[model samples]
Target: MSYKTILVHLDTSVRAHPRLETALQLAKRFDAYLIGLYAVFEPNARAFNVMAGSAGYYEVQAAMRRERAGALERLFHAELTRAGVSGEWLAPGEPADRAVPHHARCADLVVAGQDDPGDPESYIGESFREHLIMSAGRPVLLMPYTGFFATVGQVPMIAWDGGREAARAVHDALPLLKAAGRASIVTVDTKADDAGPRIASADIAACIARHGVEVEMVSSVSDAQASAGDMLLSRASDLGADLVVMGGYGHTRLRELVLGGATRTFLESMTVPVLMSH
Candidate 1:
C-alpha cells in the first residue's frame, strides 16, 4: 500500500527546502520517486510581467525561472542521494490549476500546502486542491501551513460524500487508511439536505469495508455556530484526528466549494493534514 510515485505540486512562492526535505524522507522510507511540480499560470505570469519591455528584464526573469527549477532538482538530488531518492523535475506549462491535476494523473499521490503563508487567508483562492481531487484520478495529500511534519496518513478522517470525488479519495488513500489505527467518516447536516449525508456515509463505509478498514461515522450539524468545514475540522480535532479525507466541491472558474461555507474555512485554517479529492 505504500506510494511509489509521489508528486508534490507546489508554487514558486513556497520555500523549496522544507518541502524537498519532507519528500525526500518519504522517498527514502518508501523507496519512491518524487516528482516536484511547478506550474506557471498564464494569467499570473502576464499580470506579474507587466512592465516596459526590456531585454535585461526578460533575461533576468528567464534566469530566475531556470534557477528555481535547477535549485529544486539539485536540492532534492543531494538529499535523496543519501538514500533511495529517485526524483524528476516537472514544470507543467498549463495554468497552475490545470497543470497540477495533470501531474496528479500519473502519480499515486499529490501533495500541496494548505495555505499560502504569504497571504495567510483564503487558502490560495486558486481551487488548486479542488481541481486535483476532482480530476486527478488519484489521491492528494495536502500539507498544512508551514510544511514540516512527520509521516502523514497516520491518523486519518474520511469525509463522506456519495460522489465520485469522495470515492476516488478513499480509493487512493487506501494505503493510508489501511495503515491507520483510528479513522472516521465525518459528515455535516445541511439545512435542506438530510438524505445526502446518510447515503454518503453508507457508501463510504461500504467502500472502506471492501478494503477491510473499519471507519466510524461521525455526523454533525452544519449550523450557525460555524460553517460545515469548520465544524467537521473541530470535530476531528476534538477526536484528536491527524488527517482528514474529503471530496472537494468546485469547478474551474466558479468555485463550487463556495456553496459549502464549511469547506472554505477548513481549507483556510485546518491545522492537520487533509487529503482532498474533487
Candidate 2:
C-alpha cells in the first residue's frame, strides 16, 4: 500500500536535478529508501571506433561519461543528506533504455523524466517512456521535460475510463491519493461500451472516498475535434492539479510499440507530473 523502495533515473541532462528533487520529496514523504540510478547511453567503443576510424574517440567519450557520473553521484548524496533520507547511488554503465527498467522492477515506484527532443543528451531512443511503462510492471512517475515542480501529489486528477489499465492505475496511485486528501476524477466522452453499463465515475468516487480521500466526479463531453487526452489535460489545468494519475495504454505491433492516443498526448505534452501504470 505504501512505497518502501523508490528508484529514480538520473542522467547528464539539465532536467535530472528536478527529477531527483521530486524523487527526494516522495522518498521523504513515504519514508522510503531512495535509489539514485545513473543510467545513460554510452556508445559502444568497438563499434564507434570502427565507424569514426579514430582510436581515441571512444576514450574521449568514456572519460566524459565518467566525469558526468561522478558529478551526479555527488549531487545525489548531498541532496539525500540535506533531506535526511536514507539512500544509495548506483551507476550501472549501460544503455538507460535497458538498465532503468531492469532496476525499476524491484521498486514500488519509479521516477523518470519524459523524453526531451531538444536535448540530444537525454534521448535514449524512440519510445523510451513507452517501453519503460510497458516493461516496468510498476507505477512510473514521469516528470515533464520543461517544468519545475516544487510539490507533487497535492492536488491530483485521475483520468478514468473504467478499463483494466485505468483500474490498475487507480489502485497503484492509492498512496498518493490518500495523501492528497482530495482528488478529481474526470471521465471524458464516456460511452456505455467503454466503461460498461453498471460502473460509473460516481461509483469509483465512492470507492476512493472509502479510503479517506474526498473525491469529485466530473463528466466531460469532448468536442469532435478535441481528443480525450486533450480534455484530460484541459481539466487538469482548470483544477490546478499538480499530479495526474492514469493508465499507460499501449500495444506492441510488428515489434514496435504504439501508444494509445491519450497516453501519447500526455507523454508528449504533460503540464504536470503523471503517475502511470500499465
Candidate 3:
C-alpha cells in the first residue's frame, strides 16, 4: 500500500506552514496529489441577534470572515507554487469541525497540527483533532504545536492496546511502517479491574513481519504514577522514534468529545509525529 493522495487542513494558524511543509515532503516522497483545505468556522449569530445585534452586524462579520479566507487562499497558493508539487487549494465555507472530515475521506492521509489549547482562535478547534480522527475514516498525521519535523515514518514506535482502535491504527499505518527502517511495538499492562483479556504482542509483531518491517516487541507494566501513555512516550524517546502509531479513543457526550485518558495525555505533550486512527 502507498499514499497516492494527501489532504492537509490549513488555516490562519501560525503552524500551518510547517504542517504544509511536512505534507509536501510526504507527497513528494509518494508522488501523491496534495489537497490543501482551509475551513472557516462561523460563530452562531442567531444567539447574538437576540441581544443587541442587527442584520447589519451579521453582514460585517461575514465580510471579515471572507477576507480572512481570501488571505489564507493566497498564502496557500504561494506556498504550493514555491513547492512545485502537484496540488490544489480548497476553501470551504463550512466549519472546520465538519468540513475537514468530509474532504479527508477521499485522501489516503490527512495532515494537521495539534491545537494550542490556550489559543481560542486556533484554526482547528481545540477538540477538532480527536473529532476528525474519529470521524474521518482515514489516518491522520498530527504535528505537535512546537517542533520542526523534517522527516517521519522512518523509525516508528507503536503503542499497542490489543483493542479494535489500536488494530485499526496499525492497519492504517501499514504503508508507513512498511517503508520504515525499523519499528517497535510497545505494550503496557495495567492492573486495572477491567483491563480486558491478555494478548501477545509477538503475534502482532509477526503479522507486521510479513510486511518486511524490521519489528521488535517491548512490554512493560504501568504503575499509578505513570500512565500507559507516559510509558509509551518514554520508550519512544529512548528509541529515538520519529513517528508514533496509536489509536485515537474518545466518546461523545452532549455533542462534545471526552477523550480517553491516554489519548488525551499523548496529544497534550506529544514530542513527535503521531499517526492516529479511531
Candidate 4:
C-alpha cells in the first residue's frame, strides 16, 4: 500500500540490470527507502563460483568472490545514483544472502527478481522467487526478469479460490489493485466442479467486490487433461492478463512446494507475470 521502506532482493548470480532498473523506478515513485541487498550465498553451492581448495588456492578464490560481490554492488548502485533511489547496499557475512528474510522484517515491502533470462539452462533453477514469498514473512512483489515495469500493481490478475492464501494475496494486493483501473479474478471450471470450488470462487469474488474494485470474474475449465499451470496460463492468456495475483500454492510438507501440479506449471511456464503471496 503506501510503502515507506522497500527492500529489493538482489542477486549477484546473473547481472540483474533489469531488476535493478525496475527497483529504482519503484523506489522513486513510492518515495521510499530502497535497500539493495546482495545475498552472498555459500560458495560451495554456486556452480559458477570456485571453491576454496588448498591454502594457496583459498586466497585466490575468496578474493575473486569478494570482487564479484563488489562488482555487483557497484553496478547496482550506479543505477540507483542515476535514478536517485536513495539506496544502500549490504553483503551480510554469516547467512550471506539467506539473511534477506530477517532484513525484510523491518521493511514495509519486499521486491525480488523472477528469473534469469540469460542462462536458459539454470534460469529459476532450485533458486526460485517463490521462496522469497514463502519465507519473507511479508508480502513479496516478484519483479519479472524481462519486463519494464516502472510501477507495479498496474494491470494485475487475481487468483480467486476463497481460501486463506488467496484472501491474503488479495488483501496484500489491495494497495496496488485499488490503484489500478481494472482487475480480474480467475476461477477454473467453476461450472464443472462440485459445490465446493464453485462456492469458494464466488465467495472470493464477493469479498473483493466489497472492496469497491471495478472488477470482473471469469470461470473457465481446462481441457480436462491439461496441467494445472497450463490451464491457469491459458485462461490468463485468453483474458489478455498482464499479471496474476494469487496465493503461493505450496506444499504443506517437506519440500515447501511439493503439491506439484498446477502450481509447478504456473511457476515454470508462465508467460504472463505473477504476484504470489503466501
In candidate 1, what are the lDDT values of residues 156-267, reduced to their tens digit? 8876656555676777778778867457887656554532533557776876777778778777445786667777877877877778887666544554534245456666
The per-prediction tally of clashing pairs is 5, 0, 0, 5
Per-residue lDDT tens digits of candidate 2, residues 135-197?
999999999998788899999999987777787889999999999899999875544455454
TM-score for each predicted model, relative to the true structure: 0.78, 0.94, 0.88, 0.78
Clashes of 3: 0
Pairs of residues at least 3 apart in sequence or in different chains that clash in candidate 1? 133-277, 133-278, 134-278, 228-262, 229-262
Candidate 1 segments whose C-alpha is farther than 4 A from its true place: 28-30, 41-50, 53-62, 92-95, 117-126, 161-164, 191-203, 206-210, 219-222, 252-259
Off by over 4 Å in 3: 45-68, 190-199, 253-256
> Which regions of candidate 4 are displaced past 4 Å?
45-61, 115-130, 146-151, 189-199, 209-212, 252-257
Question: On lDDT, who's better, 1 or 3?
Answer: 3
Q: Which 10-residue span in candidate 2 carries the lowest summed lDDT?
A: 190-199
lDDT by residue (20-65, candidate 3, tens digit) is 8899888888888899998755677886678675767877977876
Error of 3 at 26 (Å): 0.8
lDDT of each prediction vs. the true structure?
0.67, 0.88, 0.83, 0.66
Give Cα distance to truth, residue 85, candidate 1, Å.
Answer: 3.0
On lDDT, the stronger of 3 and 4 is 3
Q: What is the lDDT of residue 103 in candidate 3?
A: 96
For candidate 1, the TM-score is 0.78
- Enumerate residue pairs that collide in model 3: none
